[model samples]
Target: MDYRKIREAIIEETSRTHVHLVEVLGDTITTRLLKDFPEVSQVKLRISKPAAFSDCDAVGIEFLVHR
Candidate 1:
């Protein structure tokens, strides 16, 4: 798997977003990966908002994408 490409895409897309929702970010990353990498039939993304809460460890979302 070309992890470097995937990471670059995710970073490029997610870094300049007005909507900071984890679900949206996850979906965007998955879509980008699927489009860029045909070998990736499925993508699983986990986002953790570590600074969102003071008491809890983190609040995040997980998403799965399938072609």
Candidate 2:
């Protein structure tokens, strides 16, 4: 697999996305990865929002996609 292409895909998706929810972002990224990299069988994604709460480090969402 071309790691550079994969990285560029992720960057492009993230940079162009305007979604507010982490779950939606995760889904978007996962979908883009699967579409861009057919050889990939699975995608495990984690998205975080730092300092979402005063007492905790961050809030985030994680999900896995299989092809």
The candidate maximizing lDDT is 2
Clashing pairs in 2: none
CA lDDT of each candidate? Answer: 0.85, 0.89
TM-score of each: 0.85, 0.91
- State the lDDT at 54 in candidate 1: 85
Write the residue-wise lDDT of candidate 1 on 1-67 in tens digits: 8789888888898887676577887887888889999999998888898969888989999888789
**Which 10 residues in a row give candidate 1 its minimum summed lDDT?**
16-25
Residues forming the 10-long window of minimal summed lDDT in candidate 2: 17-26
Candidate 2 residue runs with Cα over 4 Å from true position: none
User: Candidate 1 — number of clashing residue pairs?
Assistant: 0
Leading candidate by TM-score: 2
Q: Report the number of clashing residue pairs per model.
A: 0, 0
